[model samples]
Target: MSAILSPRPLIKENDVKATLLSPDFLRVSQPKTFRHSIDVYLKDSNATGNIYFARHFEWQGICRERWFFECVSADMLQSLGVFITKEAQQKYVSETFAFQKIDCEVNTFGVKHCSFSLLFRFFVGGELVAVGHQQIVFANKEKKIARLPDHILAKIREYEVEKGE
Candidate 1:
């Protein structure tokens, strides 16, 4: 398949805000393949409501061979951090899967776009485990990002399963 016809643009970076408002669709990345994909939605932090992002994984092949992945830009991370308190972080760590560490990189995706690459590390106990990455592009550099993409919602689902399930 040609790159132009690929499903890459199914979700545009600019649509990050609207997608979170009400996302009825759940797009899953191909399962068990070396190439994986995810979508996450972010809800309003100041609002009095609860919106969660979830993903369902289809496991296959060798036990240790298959792993899931996800990523978020630094801008998204900071915006989320405001709402993700220490307590929330603790709860996230305890209730969800292991969060080993997050590695970040910033660069221009193309001549027309600036992007942030986040490498997420998943783990069990003190040992290292799965890994995922996200590439966020700032298509419109002039626009300010108060909210972020929904692709993270799907990533959170897998995050809850970083450890054996």
Candidate 2:
């Protein structure tokens, strides 16, 4: 298949910008996350019996939310306003069917005062099915950007796990 019709090759280049699809992106050396298990349901599938392309992005957002909830309290989260997805990149490694229990592992990257990046790897049966990445920034309902709260930043540091560990 041609590159246009198939998943594009992710080249490891010197000038390639960091995105979820980058070769430098994170994934656990081991297959199992042993955390939350996300179910792949019919709602997540397309007419062709495969997961819709956009569902990967949705699952990415879900995983991000789950991680944030772990990092802060519900009341504090409400005060934090919306977390704008500044950028996203995804690569579908293979097809995953409905009814599979997906294991997702979240990794933190590029942590800054107002923004950070997350890499989510989706796996089934110890095989990678997809990888999604997002660059997230703090913003209010008005979309006004703000510096990341110290509490959140501190948790993100504690949240990250070394890939090979």
Candidate 3:
């Protein structure tokens, strides 16, 4: 039997930060139309206390520096399903299949109209593709749940959030 190969490593911390600092990552644009809807739940379990918002459907899988917080919930993590795999994340950071956006807004509280990006690296038909400079935002006070179909949650559960010391 053949063994599986691992995805490429994430971009170097220095390089990633450098990329973020460049003028290329600084420009953001407001979309002409809304894309996706992300539901938010407050820590109090009452939706009324906090505001939550998601990118209009048009923004997903597009930006490089993607982030989700505030209304961040296990359900939100679960919604990503298999798409949140380690390999997928590696692919994302490595710019394999790049997703990027500009001037995005998530207006609830803390995270008002923040700029974001995401990068990816992946293999297709045994060939490599690197997608770079992707970004997105989730309004604070509002939580976003990625909403995945059943069966996919199994893989989603393996994902974890990292905190800085």
Candidate 4:
């Protein structure tokens, strides 16, 4: 068997920051949409009541799962294998608070032999709050990197094309 290489970040940190700051960042339409409501208990706030930085990732997880099921069938995903996050990065634009309902728009940004990238835009009350990028790899039961199934890839492409319409 050949050695597996780790996935690299598709965008540099500086580029991510620039993209997040752009006026059109949140304006870009994504193929898949997931909505989430922030609860008081999820707030890992300091004395000043600002949410902890890490909580953003947890919210991303919620959206990710929803996006997966929405775009691809859960049964198909289970039959193929598990998708693992090879790398993830987030850039926060504005502070978010409890009781805010956010819309997470996600798109299959890119695809490779063994992995794919998902870009997420978090919008709260029409304001951009944060942007997240995740590189996910499909792994078989043996935990070895596996190629994406053709059916799944086709579904992703369909969504991408639909988004452009």
Error of 3 at 148 (Å): 22
Question: Mind sharing the TM-score for model 3?
Answer: 0.20
Whole-model lDDT per candidate? 0.29, 0.74, 0.30, 0.74
lDDT of 4 at 91: 95
For residues 1-165, could you state the per-residue lDDT of candidate 4 as single tens digits?
Answer: 897776987689999999999989868664544455555444567667677778889878877787677767766477767899989999999997665666777777667667777777788878998988888899987888998888888766544523132
Summing lDDT over every window of 10 consecutive residues in candidate 1, give the lowest-scoring window: 83-92
Span of ten consecutive residues with least summed lDDT in model 2:
27-36
Q: How many backbone clashes does candidate 3 have?
A: 45
TM-score of candidate 4 on Cα atoms, chains taken together: 0.69
Candidate 4 segments whose C-alpha is farther than 4 A from its true place: 1-44, 161-165
Instruction: Supply candidate 3's per-residue lDDT for 34.
Output: 18
Q: Score candidate 3 by lDDT.
A: 0.30
User: Residue 94 of model 4: what lDDT?
Assistant: 96
> Could you tell me every candidate's TM-score relative to the true structure?
0.22, 0.69, 0.20, 0.69
lDDT of 1 by residue, 14-108 (tens): 78766765445455543222233222223311133322212111111111122321232334444343221111011113212212221211111
